[model samples]
Target: MVPEAQLRDDGAGLAPASAGWFVLNARDARWFHRPGRGDSVPLTGCDELEAETYFPMLGMSIQVLPPGEPNATYHWETEQEDFLVLAGRALLVVEGQGRQLEQWDFVHCPPETRHAFVGVGDEPCVILAASSRQFQKDGPWGFYCADEIARRYNASAPEDTQDGDVAYGRFPPSRPTRYRDGLLPD
Candidate 1:
């Protein structure tokens, strides 16, 4: 095993820094430079990418669209994305057209495009996706799920909150949805 002291690079904090600053380029240069088939990157969380990148130019992010799973349709703020499929198969449904994608396939997506990624295999559809710009200031991240789709994802947001504070339900000891018969006398 190489000593930690031996691996430090020019003190650019080459050392494995904190959670926010650690560089994930820890593998071989040749391997990454010339990746072969099935080089799926492991799924990472928001905390890791939050440090170096965010909205407006959100750093590169990789999302693996599982079998039969679809990425929530959304848009971004003038940001572009590069996607590379590693394993299985998938399709980029753009403007109602289905484009077949195989391993090692690259797809470029421009900003503000109403697009969605659909898994095309019975197996996990692996993909290595990246973006040129990071996330925008606030967000271009909004889901386009209708009432029917909401039930499919099993998600719900408060439609109306009157008589009680929204934070009341946000706090740890938040109260459950209280029903007032007078409010909805239907």
Candidate 2:
């Protein structure tokens, strides 16, 4: 990446006009947020989260994969994850394992638990995900998501609607980036 392409400000203290000369800017239409199939949840404004808290400050987003969809292909590192079933019903598959959940059910996944979320039931599956921190494999967050000990079950890019979460590259499908640098699963 060029110096200007990085998040850092240019030497002149302003963003370089040619920053995106190489990196393609995401399409405006693709930038919108539409959580579940029932309704579109577009953000009213741009947002950012600071990594600070008792447990690392987490960034969260809810996804509503209508019946027959799974989340992105991802796994955990030292970070654990918890999920709150907001609405509808679905099968939460952890690797080859599977479980049925309804609204209000709380599921806690320990660090590096091989898992994938597949939307099931007649209604849309709404879920809240919490992680330890923002994610990246080699970037600032240091999240090598693809190389995490856990591997993508291919459940991420569901070939059919009844399979899993559709590929919405908006955010990686890990849920809330919410753990501290030092947490161990109980």
TM-scores for all predictions: 0.48, 0.48
lDDT of each: 0.41, 0.45
Question: Over the stretch 27-129, how does candidate 1's per-residue lDDT look in tens digits?
Answer: 3111111011122222222333533432224444344455555543322225676788767687666543567788888888777543456566766565667
Taking the tens digit of each residue's C-alpha lDDT, what string does model 2 give over 1-186?
534333322221222132232232211111222333222211111133212321134534455666665554444445667888788786776644567889899888776565666667876676777665544323343122332212232344222222223433433433222222211112
RMSD to truth, every model: 15.5, 13.7
Query: Where is the poorest 10-residue window by lDDT in model 1?
Result: 28-37
**Residue pairs that clash (backbone atoms under 3 angstroms), model 1:** 54-135, 55-135, 55-136, 56-135, 56-136, 57-133, 57-134, 58-133, 58-134, 58-135
Off by over 4 Å in 2: 1-56, 134-186
